[model samples]
Target: MRRNVIGSVEQMTGLQVVEVNIDVTDLQLPEDDEQHPLHDGTRRVR
Candidate 1:
């Protein structure tokens, strides 16, 4: 499901995704209503 979603975004945006970076360096926990900035959107980008 995730792969298809990304692929669709890439195609629509005409951007070649070089790599999907996994951010594990800054691991500060979230507070109330402060959900993930990247995930809480129609286009999930990193």
Candidate 2:
């Protein structure tokens, strides 16, 4: 689901997806209200 959403965003915005990190170890996903490190668009994947 996440990949689909990301792919759609990339297609719509034409932003290159340089990295895709799937932290399966993080079994406890963050709550919607909580902040995620990757959620911040500060890191330039390229």
Q: Rate the local accuracy (lDDT) of all candidates.
A: 0.60, 0.62
Instruction: Give the alpha carbon lDDT tens digit for every residue of 1-46 in model 1.
Output: 4577679879999997766654454443447225765545354235
Question: Estimated TM-score per prediction?
Answer: 0.33, 0.33
Cα shift from native, residue 27, model 2 (Å): 18
In TM-score terms, candidate 2 sits at 0.33
Worst window of 10 by summed lDDT in candidate 1: 24-33
Model 2 regions more than 4 Å off: 17-46
User: Where is model 1 more than 4 Å wrong at Cα?
Assistant: 17-46
Best by TM-score: 2
Q: Write the per-residue lDDT of candidate 2 for residues 1-46, one digit (tens) a residue.
A: 6688679879998997776665543343448324664565343442
Candidate 1 to truth, TM: 0.33
Model 2 residue 5 CA deviation in Å: 0.4
